[model samples]
Target: MYRPKTTLEQWRILQAVVDHGGYAHAAEKLNKSQSSLNHAVAKLQSQLGVQLLEVRGRKAYLTEAGEVMLRRSRHLTQNVQDLESLAANIQQHWEPEITLAVDLAFPRSLLYPSLQQFLPECRGSRLKIIDTVITGTEEAITQGWADLVISHHVPKGHLGEVIAQVNFLLVCHPEHPLSQTSGPIDPNELSQHLQLVIADTSQSPDEKQGWLKSEARWTVSQFHTAVDLLLQGIGFCWLPEHVVQPHLADGLLKQLDLDGSSFRRLVSYLVKPRPDNIGPGSQLLYDLILSNRQVIRQDDNTATTGNNP
Candidate 1:
């Protein structure tokens, strides 16, 4: 067994020599004397009982054994750097990790922008983003699984700040039977056709919600699935305008002229009630959401008139 008493400084000097092409350049980069850099590498080679470097022309090249040691040294150095970063983050009172439960109804355009804004400030922190349906966000918070939640429903007695509003449009493929109707289609008329519905992703999966009067209904777990099915001319369903905007513009889907104005749902961002439970990372995220609330609430052009709430 080749037991070497090589310090990290010796390995660092060895790597620097290979990286910078020569001991002279490595000494310049590390702000050390060329003799010191040379001595460190020489000591490492002697301790390891191996010839680690061979100078060809002006530069030094690592021998095969030296290459193996260099690779392992990289992992060790990276782990040390990570530990330093974690220590610094802890000193700043930032959470090591934060969990955010967001509603599926929340548009990606809005969600991504918020995350982009949060990334720079919380570089050392980790984030877990959960996409949920109506009650999924609620369940995550109640179960202590989420530190922050962006949801349409606020649990009773918990104060929620309205962050944005998502407008829902009843849309279907152009060739569907509903598109052939002469005027505003009645709710009774809608009950006859197949309705595509996104299944609630909560523990209580049977809790029927939304305008689902249609006896013939197909259920799915994601809005993307429902959108895909709509594009395939499989069924008609009420979907978020933001998710379906490009399709509407491409003429793949058309809004049904319903009896009333468009249906709009207001969404809110809620921090877990106990202030002590939130850390610096979660607090920064919550502040960003509050600041960008109005920007996310703006209406999109895809909305048409509807009568139902």
Candidate 2:
């Protein structure tokens, strides 16, 4: 009920009438004469330039503005109570916690290291990373399961900006006969080759059908699994750069030249509706992620998310 520059007494008068039902009853509650209560109400109306009550003979009722003010007063009082509770917790240095969901394709090898190294910059807050690769960033935000997510698909509602971009490339065992071809390969020709695919839950029916272009197929649920399979000279799979860097260097997999689709994927940042004040930890973590974005590789790695389009 405390007002900074404005007097709180005026609000008290309004609440009193709302609670006591009439000006005379409010005067009794305030231990003031009826004329004193009347003058206080008039002074408040003049100051605010708004009517608060209507009086008819023995009856005094709140005007529409008065009712509106009463509701706002109640809300303001609750806000103060909440602030007090929050301050008490903060005075003890309670760390705010955030839960996040990330796709399995989150380039864990790189992202996890950076997250741990940069987390201190987030100012002592704790972060819980939830694994929800199939549900995707959009579903995580809408269902309130995560505060932030990363995926190729820009979340449908209140999407954060596309903080970074990365592309996927097709690769296979270097000794495979298909790799022996000198020129760009055709998608239809792949129908005869062994095609290893990482079938994540985020895939649409169309994406599934694209991989179906292969006559002989090996389906692996995770990207790493597909990468291993491809390395074993089993089949080819697209991979993200971070996940495939070491493998590509080791000559475990080789990139395939394609004439049709480049199979590029757009990595985006997604965040939920947040308070105006983003916590120090969140802001710091967000900035660090932004700074390290130069690592977004244009080349396709060993095993990666399939092309969405």
Candidate 3:
């Protein structure tokens, strides 16, 4: 089946090579002789039926197959380690735990599903989910308070790929005065009726200035709070489209059209170490988060343009 697995010796060897950059260096790292490393590599090659390295003038070069094995092996090793760490985190993850430095707000419903589908498979890594503001999130990244961070593609230093598009949606109460009115209204008028905004996220303040006029009924930092206030008929806010799909269709809320406002949320996945370049845990988390985003997108289309949402 071409199954890939890592061993204790393989683990040590991989670390040696990574640390020292070649078989001889690896031998030096493990305090073992170069002949011993050569023998071990030969054994590994035979077991995997592949050429792992090439000896060139007392140096070593990993073949393509060897590189693949190296990446996969490291990933598997990290996963095993993460499994152990998660066990100790279960109680804490359940106790308002699992620290995540996300944008001002994310989808609560989607997050539950993301956790439900992925966490159990992770051997129940206890989570301590905490939310820090945007600038604080960047600081958390620097300080190590956040084990993982999820934000947009900011101009400053970044860490991961742009997974999908996070669309901006202008939503309001179903019975609000806006829905009753005609075609797309001016940004100035729309801003006048109601306003709910996120103060700190990956977005530029100038980016949201137009969507949120000079006068805002409520200016909050979290999406949940904004949604709550919007549902209460306080004011409208420009939110990620997927987050407000259900509420809009349930007749609980409505999406407003800004004829002149340039509002859009380009979804991006910013994670340290990244997916392809990250450890197994981060990879799993990234995949799960993106998967949840796809599901959320599906739900959004079905509800927004369909007859019955």
Candidate 4:
């Protein structure tokens, strides 16, 4: 193998000299003799066959070539430092990556804030988020595909805690026939129109939820698609209140007045698939979600009691 006659220490010394403005200042900062810094830089320049620095009165500056080399060297040094951090994190048993499976019904207001809090504390760990619906969430837990899960269903033999309750409103386009009905509509009447439902994302047999057994039913993979269909006045379906709140406020969609309860409350749980081997990063995120849920609950209560303007 052909080995190059240079070292990272030599590049770092050159960087320090340029950064501190001179050999004397760099030596003072590095707690090294000025002569050693001079020798290292001289040797580095000789090995590379390039003049890296230009010294004017009382200070050192980079040459045209030195600027390019220094920029490249900075990236190299940073990558090395990151690699070291990753090694240390692995040694301490911190997961290299943690996967979180979240149901489509989970409120984005709470999920985004909890993720923002977890970012700074991840310590070189990566986050993988799986957006699942219904049985897909349970499949993630049973298939060992996730470290943490936020879903309505907790698979058998797994433990979970209720973190948030998502309020789902049955709505449709303002011009839809259902919206034209003045009184509480019967379930039989709802079965006459088209119903849009999200398809199960799991590999297992597809399970259906919230279907009114309408002859005209559309099964889509995502909530956004369903919303788009609703906007086109194609069908009506139950959607998360937070997701459709903007549409409702803009008068694009209207909630149906059902004979019974018009809204559905789905209680979501925070589940640990591998509770015995939970890592610190996952645990920290778990706690953050729980704490944020409490604050959200308080806000909801205040709004419900008409205490917030």
User: What is the C-alpha lDDT profile of model 1 across 1-309, one tens digit per residue?
Assistant: 966487878988888998898999999999999999888988888988999898899789988988898899989877878788888888877778888888888876666666789998885788988888877667876676888888877777566776666779999999999989988988888889999988777887545457878999998988889989988888889899888889999999998987764465555555564466778789888887766564341355333222211
- Structural similarity to truth (TM-score) of each candidate: 0.80, 0.55, 0.50, 0.91
Winner by TM-score: 4
TM-score of 2: 0.55
In Å, residue 81's CA in model 4 sits off its true spot by 0.7
User: Candidate 1's error at 88, in angstroms?
Assistant: 4.7
Model 4 earns a TM-score of 0.91
TM-score rank order: 4, 1, 2, 3
RMSD (Å) per prediction: 5.2, 16.9, 16.8, 3.3
Better of 3 and 4 by lDDT: 4
Query: Model-by-model lDDT, in order?
Result: 0.79, 0.66, 0.62, 0.85
Query: What does candidate 3's lDDT look like per residue over 125-235, in tens digits?
Result: 445665645455555555555556765544355565443446778888877787777888776667567576666543333343334454746668678788898888877
Model 1: lDDT equals: 0.79
What are the runs in model 1 whose C-alpha is more than 4 Å off? 1-6, 16-37, 47-50, 55-72, 87-93, 206-208, 268-273, 296-309
* Model 4 global lDDT (CA atoms, 0 to 1): 0.85
Alpha-carbon deviation at 6 in model 1, angstroms:
4.1
Give the better candidate number (1 or 4) by TM-score. Answer: 4
